[model samples]
Target: MKNRNIDFSMVLALTVHDMKNSLGMLLNSLDELRMENENTFDDSSKFNTLQYEAERIHNDLVQLLGIYRLGENNLSAHVEEHFVPDFLSEHLARHTPLLKGLDIECSIVAEDINGFFDADLLTGVLNNTINNAIRYTKTRIRLTANEQDGYLVIGVEDDGEGYPEHMQHSGTLSFKSLDFNTGSTSLGLLFVSAVADLHCEGERTGHIKLHNGGPLGGGVFELWLP
Candidate 1:
Protein backbone atom coordinates (compact mmCIF):
# COMPACT_ATOMS: atom_id res chain seq x y z
CA MET A 1 0.00 0.00 0.00
CA LYS A 2 1.22 3.52 -0.78
CA ASN A 3 1.57 5.88 2.13
CA ARG A 4 -0.62 9.02 2.02
CA ASN A 5 1.72 11.91 2.55
CA ILE A 6 0.52 15.41 3.46
CA ASP A 7 1.31 17.87 0.69
CA PHE A 8 1.95 21.36 2.00
CA SER A 9 1.34 22.93 -1.40
CA MET A 10 -2.12 21.41 -1.71
CA VAL A 11 -2.96 22.60 1.77
CA LEU A 12 -1.87 26.11 1.03
CA ALA A 13 -3.75 26.13 -2.27
CA LEU A 14 -6.94 25.03 -0.57
CA THR A 15 -6.53 27.67 2.08
CA VAL A 16 -6.13 30.41 -0.49
CA HIS A 17 -9.09 29.11 -2.47
CA ASP A 18 -11.25 29.30 0.63
CA MET A 19 -10.11 32.81 1.33
CA LYS A 20 -10.94 33.86 -2.24
CA ASN A 21 -14.42 32.40 -1.98
CA SER A 22 -15.05 34.27 1.26
CA LEU A 23 -13.84 37.51 -0.24
CA GLY A 24 -16.12 37.02 -3.23
CA MET A 25 -19.08 36.58 -0.95
CA LEU A 26 -18.18 39.79 0.81
CA LEU A 27 -18.02 41.61 -2.51
CA ASN A 28 -21.40 40.26 -3.44
CA SER A 29 -22.84 41.46 -0.17
CA LEU A 30 -21.42 44.89 -0.77
CA ASP A 31 -22.94 44.89 -4.24
CA GLU A 32 -26.35 44.09 -2.83
CA LEU A 33 -26.10 46.85 -0.28
CA ARG A 34 -25.01 49.37 -2.86
CA MET A 35 -27.87 48.39 -5.13
CA GLU A 36 -30.43 48.70 -2.39
CA ASN A 37 -29.37 52.23 -1.62
CA GLU A 38 -28.22 53.35 -5.02
CA ASN A 39 -29.91 56.76 -4.90
CA THR A 40 -29.46 57.30 -1.21
CA PHE A 41 -25.77 56.39 -1.34
CA ASP A 42 -24.86 57.71 -4.73
CA ASP A 43 -21.21 58.74 -4.76
CA SER A 44 -20.70 57.21 -1.35
CA SER A 45 -17.00 57.19 -0.76
CA LYS A 46 -17.21 54.82 2.19
CA PHE A 47 -18.90 52.03 0.24
CA ASN A 48 -16.59 52.49 -2.69
CA THR A 49 -13.53 52.30 -0.49
CA LEU A 50 -14.76 49.12 1.18
CA GLN A 51 -15.52 47.53 -2.18
CA TYR A 52 -12.11 48.51 -3.50
CA GLU A 53 -10.35 46.96 -0.54
CA ALA A 54 -12.35 43.77 -0.89
CA GLU A 55 -11.48 43.58 -4.56
CA ARG A 56 -7.83 44.09 -3.75
CA ILE A 57 -7.91 41.16 -1.38
CA HIS A 58 -9.68 39.07 -3.99
CA ASN A 59 -7.04 39.96 -6.58
CA ASP A 60 -4.19 39.21 -4.22
CA LEU A 61 -5.57 35.74 -3.54
CA VAL A 62 -5.97 35.15 -7.25
CA GLN A 63 -2.36 36.13 -7.85
CA LEU A 64 -1.21 33.92 -5.03
CA LEU A 65 -3.03 30.99 -6.62
CA GLY A 66 -1.52 31.90 -9.98
CA ILE A 67 1.95 31.82 -8.47
CA TYR A 68 1.23 28.35 -7.19
CA ARG A 69 0.13 27.24 -10.64
CA LEU A 70 3.19 28.77 -12.32
CA GLY A 71 5.47 26.79 -10.07
CA GLU A 72 3.83 23.55 -11.21
CA ASN A 73 4.72 21.82 -14.50
CA ASN A 74 1.05 21.26 -15.37
CA LEU A 75 0.06 24.88 -15.81
CA SER A 76 -1.26 25.64 -19.31
CA ALA A 77 -3.65 27.92 -21.15
CA HIS A 78 -7.21 27.04 -22.16
CA VAL A 79 -7.44 29.17 -25.24
CA GLU A 80 -10.52 30.02 -27.27
CA GLU A 81 -11.57 32.48 -29.93
CA HIS A 82 -13.82 35.31 -28.76
CA PHE A 83 -15.28 38.35 -30.44
CA VAL A 84 -13.25 41.35 -29.40
CA PRO A 85 -15.93 43.89 -28.59
CA ASP A 86 -18.14 41.42 -26.81
CA PHE A 87 -15.25 40.16 -24.72
CA LEU A 88 -14.28 43.66 -23.72
CA SER A 89 -17.87 44.51 -22.90
CA GLU A 90 -18.24 41.54 -20.60
CA HIS A 91 -14.98 42.40 -18.88
CA LEU A 92 -16.21 45.94 -18.31
CA ALA A 93 -19.47 44.68 -16.87
CA ARG A 94 -17.54 42.91 -14.16
CA HIS A 95 -16.32 46.28 -12.90
CA THR A 96 -19.61 48.19 -13.07
CA PRO A 97 -19.91 47.70 -9.36
CA LEU A 98 -16.78 49.68 -8.78
CA LEU A 99 -17.20 52.35 -11.46
CA LYS A 100 -20.49 53.88 -10.34
CA GLY A 101 -20.49 57.56 -11.27
CA LEU A 102 -17.42 59.59 -10.24
CA ASP A 103 -17.65 61.07 -13.75
CA ILE A 104 -15.72 58.17 -15.21
CA GLU A 105 -16.75 56.78 -18.57
CA CYS A 106 -15.51 53.64 -20.34
CA SER A 107 -15.89 52.44 -23.90
CA ILE A 108 -14.58 49.70 -26.16
CA VAL A 109 -13.57 49.84 -29.84
CA ALA A 110 -13.15 46.83 -32.08
CA GLU A 111 -13.97 46.39 -35.74
CA ASP A 112 -15.26 42.86 -36.29
CA ILE A 113 -11.98 41.34 -35.16
CA ASN A 114 -11.56 38.31 -32.93
CA GLY A 115 -8.85 37.29 -30.48
CA PHE A 116 -7.77 33.90 -29.24
CA PHE A 117 -6.97 33.83 -25.55
CA ASP A 118 -7.65 31.96 -22.37
CA ALA A 119 -10.71 33.80 -21.14
CA ASP A 120 -10.27 33.06 -17.45
CA LEU A 121 -6.58 33.91 -17.49
CA LEU A 122 -7.16 37.14 -19.34
CA THR A 123 -9.93 38.01 -16.93
CA GLY A 124 -7.50 37.85 -14.08
CA VAL A 125 -5.03 39.98 -15.99
CA LEU A 126 -7.69 42.55 -16.79
CA ASN A 127 -9.00 42.49 -13.26
CA ASN A 128 -5.75 43.98 -12.09
CA THR A 129 -5.72 46.56 -14.86
CA ILE A 130 -9.32 47.66 -14.34
CA ASN A 131 -8.87 47.96 -10.58
CA ASN A 132 -5.71 49.96 -11.00
CA ALA A 133 -7.15 52.15 -13.76
CA ILE A 134 -10.29 52.99 -11.82
CA ARG A 135 -8.09 54.50 -9.16
CA TYR A 136 -6.04 56.66 -11.53
CA THR A 137 -8.28 57.51 -14.45
CA LYS A 138 -9.44 61.12 -14.50
CA THR A 139 -12.57 60.91 -16.60
CA ARG A 140 -12.30 58.27 -19.29
CA ILE A 141 -11.05 54.77 -20.02
CA ARG A 142 -10.83 53.11 -23.39
CA LEU A 143 -10.31 49.48 -24.33
CA THR A 144 -9.18 48.62 -27.83
CA ALA A 145 -8.61 45.33 -29.60
CA ASN A 146 -6.96 44.82 -32.97
CA GLU A 147 -4.41 42.77 -34.80
CA GLN A 148 -0.86 44.07 -34.88
CA ASP A 149 2.04 42.48 -36.72
CA GLY A 150 0.65 38.93 -36.48
CA TYR A 151 -0.49 39.27 -32.89
CA LEU A 152 -3.70 40.16 -31.13
CA VAL A 153 -3.17 43.45 -29.34
CA ILE A 154 -5.53 44.50 -26.55
CA GLY A 155 -5.05 47.87 -24.90
CA VAL A 156 -6.36 49.46 -21.71
CA GLU A 157 -5.90 53.20 -21.68
CA ASP A 158 -6.97 55.93 -19.31
CA ASP A 159 -7.03 59.72 -19.35
CA GLY A 160 -4.90 60.21 -16.29
CA GLU A 161 -1.31 60.12 -15.18
CA GLY A 162 0.65 57.33 -16.86
CA TYR A 163 2.90 54.61 -15.64
CA PRO A 164 6.04 55.57 -13.76
CA GLU A 165 9.19 55.79 -15.86
CA HIS A 166 10.73 52.71 -14.30
CA MET A 167 7.89 50.46 -15.55
CA GLN A 168 7.68 51.70 -19.12
CA HIS A 169 9.63 48.82 -20.63
CA SER A 170 9.03 47.56 -24.18
CA GLY A 171 7.98 44.08 -23.10
CA THR A 172 7.17 42.18 -19.96
CA LEU A 173 9.99 42.93 -17.57
CA SER A 174 11.51 40.06 -15.67
CA PHE A 175 10.32 39.80 -12.08
CA LYS A 176 13.90 39.73 -10.86
CA SER A 177 14.61 43.03 -12.66
CA LEU A 178 11.59 44.85 -11.19
CA ASP A 179 12.26 47.79 -8.88
CA PHE A 180 12.34 46.07 -5.51
CA ASN A 181 14.06 49.03 -3.86
CA THR A 182 10.72 50.71 -3.14
CA GLY A 183 9.02 47.43 -2.32
CA SER A 184 6.54 48.22 -5.10
CA THR A 185 7.02 45.14 -7.19
CA SER A 186 3.49 44.67 -8.58
CA LEU A 187 2.06 41.27 -7.82
CA GLY A 188 -0.47 41.89 -10.60
CA LEU A 189 2.36 42.46 -13.07
CA LEU A 190 4.04 39.26 -12.01
CA PHE A 191 0.79 37.29 -12.33
CA VAL A 192 0.03 38.64 -15.79
CA SER A 193 3.60 37.95 -16.93
CA ALA A 194 3.34 34.34 -15.86
CA VAL A 195 -0.01 33.93 -17.60
CA ALA A 196 1.51 35.39 -20.75
CA ASP A 197 4.44 33.00 -20.49
CA LEU A 198 2.06 30.04 -20.33
CA HIS A 199 0.61 30.94 -23.72
CA CYS A 200 2.82 30.23 -26.73
CA GLU A 201 2.75 29.36 -30.40
CA GLY A 202 5.57 28.68 -32.85
CA GLU A 203 8.24 30.57 -30.86
CA ARG A 204 5.88 33.38 -30.01
CA THR A 205 4.42 33.82 -26.55
CA GLY A 206 2.01 36.32 -25.07
CA HIS A 207 3.56 39.35 -23.35
CA ILE A 208 2.49 42.46 -21.43
CA LYS A 209 3.70 45.97 -22.14
CA LEU A 210 3.44 49.20 -20.15
CA HIS A 211 3.56 52.49 -21.96
CA ASN A 212 2.39 56.10 -21.77
CA GLY A 213 0.09 57.84 -24.25
CA GLY A 214 -2.43 56.15 -26.48
CA PRO A 215 -5.71 57.57 -27.73
CA LEU A 216 -6.26 58.75 -24.18
CA GLY A 217 -2.83 60.32 -23.87
CA GLY A 218 -2.26 58.57 -20.57
CA GLY A 219 -1.25 55.23 -19.13
CA VAL A 220 -1.68 52.33 -21.56
CA PHE A 221 -1.51 48.62 -20.83
CA GLU A 222 -1.14 46.37 -23.83
CA LEU A 223 -1.36 42.58 -23.80
CA TRP A 224 -0.06 40.90 -26.90
CA LEU A 225 -1.11 37.35 -27.70
CA PRO A 226 0.40 35.27 -30.47
Candidate 2:
Protein backbone atom coordinates (compact mmCIF):
# COMPACT_ATOMS: atom_id res chain seq x y z
CA MET A 1 0.00 0.00 0.00
CA LYS A 2 1.15 3.50 -0.82
CA ASN A 3 1.08 6.36 1.68
CA ARG A 4 -1.17 9.31 0.79
CA ASN A 5 -0.74 12.96 1.68
CA ILE A 6 -3.23 14.73 3.92
CA ASP A 7 -5.76 17.13 2.40
CA PHE A 8 -5.40 20.91 2.61
CA SER A 9 -9.03 21.72 3.53
CA MET A 10 -8.20 20.83 7.09
CA VAL A 11 -5.72 23.69 7.19
CA LEU A 12 -8.23 26.06 5.60
CA ALA A 13 -10.79 25.21 8.29
CA LEU A 14 -8.55 26.85 10.82
CA THR A 15 -9.11 30.20 9.13
CA VAL A 16 -12.61 30.40 10.65
CA HIS A 17 -11.41 29.36 14.08
CA ASP A 18 -11.60 32.81 15.66
CA MET A 19 -15.33 32.67 16.45
CA LYS A 20 -15.05 30.15 19.29
CA ASN A 21 -12.16 31.84 21.04
CA SER A 22 -13.78 35.28 20.91
CA LEU A 23 -17.17 33.96 21.95
CA GLY A 24 -15.62 32.15 24.90
CA MET A 25 -14.02 35.38 26.07
CA LEU A 26 -17.35 37.16 25.67
CA LEU A 27 -19.18 34.51 27.73
CA ASN A 28 -16.61 34.80 30.50
CA SER A 29 -17.11 38.56 30.61
CA LEU A 30 -20.89 38.08 30.77
CA ASP A 31 -20.48 35.66 33.67
CA GLU A 32 -18.51 38.29 35.55
CA LEU A 33 -21.23 40.84 34.87
CA ARG A 34 -23.90 38.47 36.18
CA MET A 35 -22.02 37.91 39.43
CA GLU A 36 -21.20 41.57 39.98
CA ASN A 37 -24.79 42.71 39.54
CA GLU A 38 -26.91 39.81 40.54
CA ASN A 39 -29.49 42.33 41.74
CA THR A 40 -28.44 45.46 39.90
CA PHE A 41 -31.32 45.68 37.50
CA ASP A 42 -35.02 45.56 38.31
CA ASP A 43 -35.03 41.88 37.41
CA SER A 44 -32.79 39.37 35.72
CA SER A 45 -33.60 41.03 32.39
CA LYS A 46 -30.21 42.67 31.97
CA PHE A 47 -28.48 39.41 32.54
CA ASN A 48 -30.98 37.81 30.20
CA THR A 49 -29.91 40.05 27.36
CA LEU A 50 -26.32 39.25 28.11
CA GLN A 51 -27.14 35.58 28.16
CA TYR A 52 -29.11 35.66 24.90
CA GLU A 53 -26.27 37.36 23.05
CA ALA A 54 -23.80 34.99 24.61
CA GLU A 55 -25.91 32.03 23.55
CA ARG A 56 -26.03 33.39 20.02
CA ILE A 57 -22.28 33.59 20.03
CA HIS A 58 -22.11 30.05 21.32
CA ASN A 59 -24.43 28.68 18.63
CA ASP A 60 -22.34 30.35 15.97
CA LEU A 61 -19.25 28.78 17.46
CA VAL A 62 -20.89 25.38 17.37
CA GLN A 63 -21.67 25.84 13.68
CA LEU A 64 -18.11 26.82 12.99
CA LEU A 65 -16.87 23.74 14.77
CA GLY A 66 -19.26 21.54 12.82
CA ILE A 67 -18.07 23.00 9.56
CA TYR A 68 -14.49 22.28 10.54
CA ARG A 69 -15.42 18.73 11.43
CA LEU A 70 -17.16 18.22 8.11
CA GLY A 71 -14.20 19.58 6.18
CA GLU A 72 -11.96 17.05 7.88
CA ASN A 73 -14.52 14.23 7.65
CA ASN A 74 -13.99 13.67 11.35
CA LEU A 75 -17.55 14.32 12.55
CA SER A 76 -18.44 10.94 13.96
CA ALA A 77 -21.33 10.04 16.22
CA HIS A 78 -20.60 8.77 19.73
CA VAL A 79 -23.88 7.47 21.10
CA GLU A 80 -24.32 6.28 24.67
CA GLU A 81 -27.39 5.51 26.77
CA HIS A 82 -28.59 8.37 28.94
CA PHE A 83 -31.63 9.66 30.84
CA VAL A 84 -33.49 12.30 28.83
CA PRO A 85 -34.82 14.24 31.81
CA ASP A 86 -31.43 14.60 33.43
CA PHE A 87 -29.82 15.68 30.20
CA LEU A 88 -32.48 18.29 29.57
CA SER A 89 -32.23 19.59 33.12
CA GLU A 90 -28.46 19.91 32.92
CA HIS A 91 -28.64 21.98 29.73
CA LEU A 92 -31.45 24.12 31.15
CA ALA A 93 -29.47 24.84 34.28
CA ARG A 94 -26.55 26.01 32.21
CA HIS A 95 -28.82 28.47 30.35
CA THR A 96 -31.29 29.43 33.12
CA PRO A 97 -29.78 32.80 33.87
CA LEU A 98 -30.19 33.82 30.24
CA LEU A 99 -33.68 32.37 29.86
CA LYS A 100 -34.98 34.25 32.87
CA GLY A 101 -33.31 37.32 31.49
CA LEU A 102 -35.03 36.93 28.10
CA ASP A 103 -38.50 36.60 29.67
CA ILE A 104 -38.85 33.11 28.22
CA GLU A 105 -39.87 30.26 30.50
CA CYS A 106 -38.66 26.80 29.51
CA SER A 107 -40.31 23.59 30.67
CA ILE A 108 -38.85 20.17 29.98
CA VAL A 109 -40.95 17.00 30.25
CA ALA A 110 -39.00 13.81 29.65
CA GLU A 111 -40.48 11.36 32.08
CA ASP A 112 -39.80 7.62 31.52
CA ILE A 113 -37.60 8.27 28.51
CA ASN A 114 -34.03 7.11 28.07
CA GLY A 115 -31.84 6.61 25.04
CA PHE A 116 -28.37 6.35 23.52
CA PHE A 117 -26.97 9.45 21.81
CA ASP A 118 -23.93 11.53 21.08
CA ALA A 119 -24.04 13.91 24.00
CA ASP A 120 -21.83 16.75 22.81
CA LEU A 121 -23.29 17.04 19.32
CA LEU A 122 -26.83 16.66 20.63
CA THR A 123 -26.19 19.42 23.13
CA GLY A 124 -25.17 21.77 20.35
CA VAL A 125 -28.17 20.82 18.23
CA LEU A 126 -30.64 21.28 21.11
CA ASN A 127 -29.05 24.58 22.04
CA ASN A 128 -29.61 25.86 18.51
CA THR A 129 -33.23 24.71 18.54
CA ILE A 130 -33.86 26.28 21.93
CA ASN A 131 -32.15 29.49 20.87
CA ASN A 132 -34.45 29.74 17.87
CA ALA A 133 -37.48 28.99 20.06
CA ILE A 134 -36.47 31.70 22.47
CA ARG A 135 -36.09 34.15 19.59
CA TYR A 136 -39.63 33.59 18.30
CA THR A 137 -41.55 32.50 21.35
CA LYS A 138 -43.86 34.95 23.09
CA THR A 139 -43.35 33.64 26.61
CA ARG A 140 -42.85 29.92 26.85
CA ILE A 141 -41.12 26.96 25.24
CA ARG A 142 -41.39 23.29 26.07
CA LEU A 143 -39.00 20.39 25.53
CA THR A 144 -40.78 17.03 25.42
CA ALA A 145 -39.37 13.57 24.91
CA ASN A 146 -41.14 10.27 24.38
CA GLU A 147 -40.60 6.90 22.78
CA GLN A 148 -42.44 6.04 19.58
CA ASP A 149 -42.03 3.09 17.25
CA GLY A 150 -38.66 2.15 18.70
CA TYR A 151 -37.37 5.68 18.33
CA LEU A 152 -36.85 8.44 20.85
CA VAL A 153 -38.57 11.62 19.72
CA ILE A 154 -37.44 14.88 21.24
CA GLY A 155 -39.30 18.06 20.42
CA VAL A 156 -38.74 21.76 20.99
CA GLU A 157 -41.99 23.66 20.78
CA ASP A 158 -42.69 27.34 21.06
CA ASP A 159 -45.71 29.64 21.47
CA GLY A 160 -45.46 32.29 18.83
CA GLU A 161 -46.22 32.95 15.18
CA GLY A 162 -45.50 29.62 13.57
CA TYR A 163 -43.62 28.90 10.40
CA PRO A 164 -45.32 29.23 7.05
CA GLU A 165 -46.85 26.02 5.76
CA HIS A 166 -44.69 25.99 2.64
CA MET A 167 -41.51 26.45 4.61
CA GLN A 168 -42.02 23.29 6.61
CA HIS A 169 -42.18 21.01 3.61
CA SER A 170 -39.24 22.49 1.76
CA GLY A 171 -36.79 20.40 3.84
CA THR A 172 -34.42 23.31 3.63
CA LEU A 173 -33.61 26.29 5.77
CA SER A 174 -36.49 28.36 4.48
CA PHE A 175 -35.88 31.21 6.88
CA LYS A 176 -32.39 31.71 5.56
CA SER A 177 -33.43 31.34 1.96
CA LEU A 178 -36.15 33.96 2.27
CA ASP A 179 -34.01 36.49 4.05
CA PHE A 180 -30.49 36.16 2.77
CA ASN A 181 -29.47 39.72 3.58
CA THR A 182 -30.46 39.48 7.21
CA GLY A 183 -28.16 38.48 10.06
CA SER A 184 -29.89 35.11 10.49
CA THR A 185 -27.43 32.84 8.77
CA SER A 186 -28.39 29.21 8.11
CA LEU A 187 -25.45 28.09 10.24
CA GLY A 188 -27.61 26.67 13.01
CA LEU A 189 -29.85 24.78 10.59
CA LEU A 190 -26.80 23.40 8.82
CA PHE A 191 -25.38 22.32 12.16
CA VAL A 192 -28.64 20.56 13.08
CA SER A 193 -28.78 18.70 9.79
CA ALA A 194 -25.15 17.63 10.04
CA VAL A 195 -25.55 16.35 13.58
CA ALA A 196 -28.70 14.45 12.70
CA ASP A 197 -27.12 12.82 9.70
CA LEU A 198 -24.02 11.81 11.63
CA HIS A 199 -26.16 9.57 13.86
CA CYS A 200 -26.26 6.63 11.51
CA GLU A 201 -25.31 3.02 12.08
CA GLY A 202 -25.87 0.36 9.42
CA GLU A 203 -29.47 0.73 8.24
CA ARG A 204 -30.67 2.97 11.09
CA THR A 205 -30.01 6.65 11.61
CA GLY A 206 -31.37 9.69 13.41
CA HIS A 207 -33.34 12.36 11.56
CA ILE A 208 -34.92 15.73 12.26
CA LYS A 209 -37.89 17.62 10.91
CA LEU A 210 -39.65 20.94 11.35
CA HIS A 211 -43.35 21.37 12.04
CA ASN A 212 -45.65 24.27 12.85
CA GLY A 213 -48.49 22.59 14.69
CA GLY A 214 -48.07 21.08 18.13
CA PRO A 215 -49.25 21.57 21.71
CA LEU A 216 -47.65 25.00 21.63
CA GLY A 217 -49.34 25.75 18.28
CA GLY A 218 -46.14 27.31 17.00
CA GLY A 219 -42.90 26.12 15.54
CA VAL A 220 -41.87 22.60 16.50
CA PHE A 221 -38.45 21.05 15.96
CA GLU A 222 -38.45 17.29 16.26
CA LEU A 223 -35.52 14.92 16.30
CA TRP A 224 -36.01 11.17 15.98
CA LEU A 225 -33.24 8.71 16.76
CA PRO A 226 -33.49 4.96 16.44
Q: What is candidate 2's lDDT per residue for 155-226, written digit by digit as tens?
A: 899999987664473233422354556554566777777777777667777777887978888999888788
Clashing pairs in 1: none
Writing each residue's lDDT as its tens digit, candidate 1 over 125-211 gives 888888888888998988888889888888889998999998785566566876667887777888888888777889999888899
lDDT of the candidates, in the order given: 0.84, 0.77
Top candidate, metric TM-score: 1
Question: Best lDDT goes to which candidate?
Answer: 1
